[model samples]
Target: MKGSQLGEENGRRSYESLRRTAQALETRADIARAALRLFRTRGWAGTTVRDVAREAGVSVPTVYSTYGNKQGLARALADAADLTAGVPRQLAELEAAAADPPRQLAAMAGYDRRLFERAGDVLRLLREAGRIEPELAAVYDDGRVRADETRARVFSSWPDGTLRPGLDLRAATDVYAALCTVDVYTTLTAERGWSPGRVERWWSDALARELLDR
Candidate 1:
């Protein structure tokens, strides 16, 4: 009977701890969303921790504790962008398409399209914020480097003789990364008024033509 009571007590403690943890995470998410909105409207340099706190309906200290500073918030926003872009699922699908290079390239284009369509504003925010904040700049650069590495892995997974005769993995990754940058996507979708579907189709056809053997 004593052991049963003790186990029940422990379970209650665990449940309480988990509830607190979940609440903290939800608060952080709310703060991050508020920060993104402020950053988008007011500009990164123009927004402040107090502003985010007010926007999130939390204390300024809460904002600081959750994100440390504006740069930290920017990092969180980058993470949010990744989540919104469906990167993990897309990567899994990309890996599964290794046997078919055309299909893989098309998948890559699809990921790019979804990324820009869903998270372009967040990415643009990061890029703009990175210009003035050295730490945020590092974060932005790190994201780009990681993306390049992912592209390299995808290219490396291609079957033998799948690439154009002269195009090696490194070269192929360079081209792919360059062509799929947020800047290019912005140019096509924002500046040139091309639809996401149009961009996806163009990228799919373009990448296949550039990298594959006839």
Candidate 2:
């Protein structure tokens, strides 16, 4: 009887441990998705811990206990997005292109056209959703900082067709970064009422005629 009781207790403990771990994972996942949706849609001013909790179907205190506050949630979103391999994914695509400059440029153009298309649209949509959510105010900006780092890598090439050529990558990166600002694009589109197709056309043409073409 004693042996059987001990075995049963051990099994119960094991099940509890596994359950706790599963719950933690699910909670973290929910927090991440909620942050993404909330931050992107509303900005920090519009989103609140309550909003995130509502979106995740958790509770206000749950988000607070998990992340400490809105800024913590923003950092969490940044770390989570970094884990998604987006920056590395682009680098891999660039590496796989042929050695020829023009061919490589063509490949990169195609790659980035697809990339920017989604990024632009998602950010724009996020602007709408985040407007009412206070917890997401800094989240989009934080993500942009990560993207700026990637853009800097893209501009390290010399005009002479050498890829990632310069000793100082930031110089090239800043110029390209300035041109690719989301705010500028948003102002052009929302304030000026430009269509996405037209903006994309300009993006493609700008890269082709100005930067990569040289």
Candidate 3:
């Protein structure tokens, strides 16, 4: 009887611990989502840790302890979005289609479209906020560098005759990155009221014309 009671007590404690860990993960996700929404609607400078805490239905200390600060929260939000969006899988698909330059470029454009659709406002807010916050500025610059590198790699994978005459791999990558930026997406879809499908088609067509021989 004593041994059975001890085993049941240990089991109960293990269950409680698992429950607490799950709740913590859920709380963190809630906090990240709240921060992202606030950042998108209010702009980074306008949104505060208190705002996130309130929006997340948690205390300020809890937000602070969980994420450290607003910058931390923003980073967490970006990380969560990236993980949820499965960017690596998209990149794999793009790489696999590299033998077909037009198809590869279209896949790249499609990836950009999906990224912007998921987090355009958040990215814009981060860009604006980065001007004032050094940490965020670093994060923004790192993202740009990574994007440029990815574009350069994709451009490099193509055959010599693919790009327009007089355009080297570096320049082509630069142009491609600029054309597929979140800012352009926002301008076309949010400001100019172009449909998402139209934006995607435009991206595919523009990249094909600019980068491909045919």
Candidate 4:
């Protein structure tokens, strides 16, 4: 029947469209991975779009068409880093413990550890690159602001009297954010050779003791 044929054609077109979308996403992921490797090894200032294209086995035009420029590629790499770091799952853990300040703080520490373990290189790369690149600097600044807001929201959600005496929500958020910074993590883990487990344990205990009333 004519109606049946029309439905079949539509189904075929839908399938083709889905396939193309998946392919495009896969290509972008490949480019991002290639860019990450180059950036990590050569530094952002040293890596070029041509190098990324060669590493990804794509054409230079493809790289330009896909990402626009180095900044766009950096953004893609940042996104991929978050995905590899399981940021969504970590956020969920924090959200699930919203009612329990101690548990929430512990989850925050866990999130910090996991993100550093998986994406510390990417973060460090962006931070170093941000010095010369205005766009990258803005991205880094935005990340800091978001991190502060996230901690503030978590602190604001706690029940009354959760914080230590004389510590307000804003103060608690500042303390938590300060302790959770990537610089602190790198200092202990990279400079002092402390294990991530040790850092997490210390942070968890420190956050609880500093922010929560006995």
- In model 4, pairs of residues that clash are none
> TM-score of every model?
0.77, 0.52, 0.70, 0.78
Q: After superposition, how far is residue 43 of candidate 4 from its true place, in Å?
A: 1.8
User: Which is the winner by lDDT between candidate 1 and candidate 4?
Assistant: 4
lDDT of 4 by residue, 96-193 (tens): 88777788888889878887877888887778878988878776777677777888888877788889999997898888888887889999999999
* Model 3 spans with C-alpha error above 4 angstroms: 1-34, 41-69, 80-85
Candidate 2: lDDT of 146? 63
Per-residue lDDT of candidate 3, residues 1-214 (tens digit)? 6999999999999999999999998888888888877876887768899999999999999999998977787675665565554677778888688698788787778777877888776666667778888877776777778777877888888778888998898888877987988889989987999987789899999988887776
Candidate 1 lDDT over 28-74, as tens digits, reads 87887788778778977788888989999999899888889877787
Tell how far residue 1 is off in model 4, in angstroms: 13
The TM-score of predicted model 2 comes to 0.52
- What alpha-carbon RMSD in Å does predicted model 4 have with respect to the real structure? 3.6
Q: How accurate is candidate 2 locally (lDDT)?
A: 0.61
Scored against the true structure, residue 202 in model 3 reaches a CA lDDT of 96
Tens digits of lDDT, candidate 2, 1-214: 6999999999999999999998986797788678767767886568787888899999888888888787677655654454343545556766774344444444444434444444554555444545765445556665667666655545543345553334245554454556555566677677899865666566555644544534
Model 3 TM-score relative to the real fold = 0.70
Off by over 4 Å in 4: 1-28, 57-66
